[model samples]
Target: MTTEEIRAEARGQAEAHLRALVGSDSAVLRDDQWSAIEALAVDSRRALVVQRTGWGKSAVYFVATLLLRSRGAGPTVIVSPLLALMRNQIAAAERAGIRAVTINSTNIEQWQPINDAINAGEVDVLLVSPERLNNPGFRDEVMPRLAATCGLLVVDEAHCISDWGHDFRPDYRRIRTLLADLPPGIPVLATTATANARVTADVAEQLVSATGEQEVLVLRGSLDRESLRLGVVRLRTAEMRLAWLADHLAEQPGSGIVYCLTVAATQEVAAFLRDRGHEVAAYSGQTDPTERAALESALVEGRVKALVATSALGMGFDASLGFVINLGAPQSPVAYYQQVGRAGRGTDDATVVLLPQLEDRDIWAYFASLAFPPEQLVRQTLEVLAQAPGSMSTVALETYVELSRNRLETLLKVLDVDGAVRRVKGGWVATGEPWSYDADRYARVAQARQREQDAMLDYLDTDRCRMRFLRDQLDDPDATDCGRCDNCGGLTLSSSVTEAAVDEAGAALSRPGVAIEPRKMWPTALANLGLDLKGKIGDGPVEGRAIARLTDLGHGQALRALFRADAVDGPVPPPLASALLTVMKDWAGDWTDRPVAIVGVESASRPQLVGDLATGLSRVMQIPVVGRFAIVDASVAPGQGAANSAQRVAAIHRRFRLEADVPAGPVLLVDDLVVSGWTLTVAGVALREAGATAVLPLTLGTQT
Candidate 1:
């Protein structure tokens, strides 16, 4: 597209005020962002921003939408990552006091409200999920009503279109088709945080091939959160590991989170910590919906002081909780970022203490054992979308080749992620009829896709920077060490090789109580390097065995390693052996600067409390340090709160709870993960009543 062509998409009046509105509100756009936006606005060349956390991506959409709207531009249809995100954005717009509406799977009737708004010429933005973009609801009732109203189409978390993204959702792959179907020349925009080379290239491909446009504006902010300090500890044994956690917790202020890889581990840790006097709250898949809500409430209401949970804690969770204490090594860097991101929403410094525990494989392997069969998925999808018994709906199967729905609800969801199928009476019917069908090809493709998924399991076994490896598969070929990632942070461990970190405690312990670290661990080791903690030797350790690495370490070992490897003070703890590794293998094809903020805090003068845990030893250290850790009151240690007080538990669960249920002045929703986004929608509605002006959703990773 030429400059003139790009200008034509937005009316002349829109092009004038766009720049000013680009970074306003909670959008937080930076310099690089402007460069990307400018390049996109003026040049025909493709420009993209490969940003990380804290980088404003949604601002780009809002700016563009507002710009186009100024010129009497039609509505901008944004392909939301989740229903929750759409609701959040609506809440934000309402909070901003801007009239915006969205429709999703849960509320098909929303189409009426949205259509009414479009007809009244009252809506500025139309947020829809990709699945909904091609749905009968949008095509028949919504799209035709707003066809002339929609000027621009935006795909949030565009990386999900490709299998390479951290959280790939099949439905995103079909977004390009929907764009292609839209009346010619409608400019399409997309944004994402977790994009690598493969994903980036995919995005470019999507813009060119699917949308039939060469000028796609790609704007990204930085990836670094410098205010958040980095520290890595090699596991010795379970006993030593637990002791090390005790010591690390002793040094931090506010309640912290300890993420486990398994529900059993979460339960065990919570029990152990509770017995040890820490107000430990546990959350896992096993916890019912009510219990989960209670747990979330506990964190927000300031009921519990500390929490032990599995990956369940990171999904759309919003809390200014003080610290993120990791008891288990995350399966991926994306997972790690999200679990830790819950802590630093406030301006106050917060701490994310990562204690890598070799995870138990029984859980993930069990997941594999329970994975739904491809054939079943396909058949169920067809069944749900079957037309009403009396009448048939002509829906093209090829158009939905890439749709995604909740696995648990695969049988119930007659439509795709977009909610297109219309249920009249007993049977169901969808809009798009099968364009062409090669049953053989469908079967082959289905199986091949299943095999491709096997690659994720393989990813778990690879020795590369988990983040880099994932991005390369999705975005770029030249992508290398993102300098800020764990791999770039100087951490490296090959899955093919088995080498134990230094075990000599005497050498690591320089002072009587202080542990002399072998070498300061690079960021990569903190984020990558899968170590087996359940006590297995050789290749067996690579498989999910709990090789008892840190927990087994005796008395002399635990505190010493804690003082050496985990402590981030004075200077470097261990000599980074991976400097050569990083220089030689540089996984990140290119280095993208990340957003960073740092501030100083005076040490607190308070007493530290250490305790004996149930069947374990737990100690609570007074709030001594407060950096990268947010706590309302640092003085109260973990054990100070009631063992079962809802207020106390709520405080501890705060990491997963929203600050307020009501919306304030155009409140923006900030989250690390975007799944179905329904959770965020619930949050958005809650925020609205609480006085939030409007609400928008910001997610680091969206399964678009």
Candidate 2:
């Protein structure tokens, strides 16, 4: 048969497979989708597909898998980003008679069986997270075999492979080594719905063959989602945003997602919405795997109005979501596009609204602080690891390093990818590979991030066109005024919320008292730091109460303002004083033993606030004002308590001594702020040793 005749036959088979996948005889692949499939299956060429969501990107891979397997090719390997995405892909593969299996953190028990199935050639596709690629067992044991026999390699959410991408993940960089190891002529496909020209070029460069013999076919298309009607709602306060959502959320077309900038906001918003008669659930990275899966299922089945989520629910969650509302603007326009893309996938018309808050920049700044640590810290971490006798677990390393657990884990991943360290069975070991910190490159990346932030600010205030502005930010050549957004003839949502709604939301938020669970177990390796502490803390403070989390939607703002670096240290304000009294009143009702005395934790900063809070509480509850703890060493820095658990514990251990008399009864231990909770714990221990029966801690706010 002629080449055209063979291509026609392959196209026919592809369409039949697509029909089966979508469960519709009328289903057909778009022209570009077929081109991607043809490039992968027919030409055995590398391809990058940059199309909008719900554009059948998965169909291209599934159909290509069937076509390639027909010619005796091995199974396809997909590096997916999210568990929810992997679950959806496996389900879709089943529709087309393609056997798919996944190995992720959630399914440890099934990994061996899945690996056996792959070896036996019983699985047509194997899905794994990028992090799994770095797993010593998988990379050393299974990856080699799979690489040798892999028919096709797919990188879903390909933008993650580029540091220039908005959601750059260090684990995604491991793909370069895998690509280098793949056999020649193996078709590779990278697909994402959110990538600008810069990110696209970076990913395409990574897609090239190690020998530089293969060129990647780049297929870019318009990023305009016709079904979306975008708008921006400007609200002055967090309560106003909540009230607006409370009043208008049910008016949205269908069940959708409500995205929050932080986990605290997700819980606060979801709870408020539920109270306002909207069925919603909160989701964040902290959620358990089982609960996350159930929440996803609930949203998919239309059992809930929306799932208030963080970026944890961002990539590859498949649902016919009809609306998306952002309580606060994302840090960048690219992230905003990726999130709003989740809506309007199956419906012809969907609502996409952004409620931009002035506080959004504060959230952005907090995330910025978590970026790659400074050079000195990085070098110190490496030196510590190099001097270790053997492999050290993260907890063990934390005793020597000052970084938090999350930040330390992130740095280790980057070091592992850079060959400066290697993850072994028990823990991580120094690789002894020569590595240099690229300060210039990191500076440029930081500057680029700033530019993205500026662009997002422009997006919030732009009067031209919302959809077109987003498309232009993504470098979509086909961007044009959609004439469907609020700026272009669509109905604009009102920022005006009912007074009753605002009052209700404010009341809910103002009603403070977040439970501060006591740390039962001491941090690992505390003894190594020269503190005799180990195992469970014997006399820690009982479960305490704080006015709110520093990340909370309501009281957090006020507390943040008061705790600013330049803010003058003064007595507690009237409003906070009233809130404290209310907290004590509410707390006393549930107390088995009322506090007979109040004691203040010595504060290097905000001493007035701490002392005033304790004295006021004592006066209101008619309890005696006990003496406060005094700092033993005045030379200790103010933020010594902000380090890792072991470090914080060591810094504060024996640093304070009870200066006042203590009655033999429960006492309210007061502080201005609680971070790491080491100060309270140490102070509580001292007070207990001073004859107090029990310690009930209280604080203005808790920093998470």
The best candidate in terms of TM-score:
2
Error of 1 at 104 (Å): 4.4
Query: CA lDDT, every prediction?
Result: 0.46, 0.90
* Candidate 2 pairs with clashing backbones: none
lDDT of 2 by residue, 49-110 (tens): 99999898999999999999989999999999999999999999998899999999989999
Alpha-carbon TM-score of each model against the true structure: 0.50, 0.98
Cα displacement (angstroms), candidate 1, residue 320, comes to 6.2
Model 1 lDDT at residue 560: 32
Clashes of 2: 0
For every model in order, what is the number of clashing pairs?
127, 0
Candidate 1: residue 112 Cα off by (Å):
4.1
What's the residue-level lDDT of 148 in candidate 1? 49
Q: Can you write out model 1's per-residue Cα lDDT over 1-704, one digit (the tens) per residue?
A: 77666555543333333334432433333556445544433332344556654455555556556655655768777777654356446655564435677777666766677677787778888877666645544555665545445766777767667644555666675565565556655556667666655567767776773434565555544444443433445565554455455444544556556787666557656765565566777888678756776777677556787678876665345455766777655544554655666665542656655555443332333343333335554554465455324533222221122222234233223234334444333334554554222357546534544444455444445555544554454334444544433434643221121122122222222111111111111111111112111221111100001111222222222323433324543311122111212321231122132112111111122111001110011011121111111234555543231221222322233322234333123333432223333334434444444554544332222222
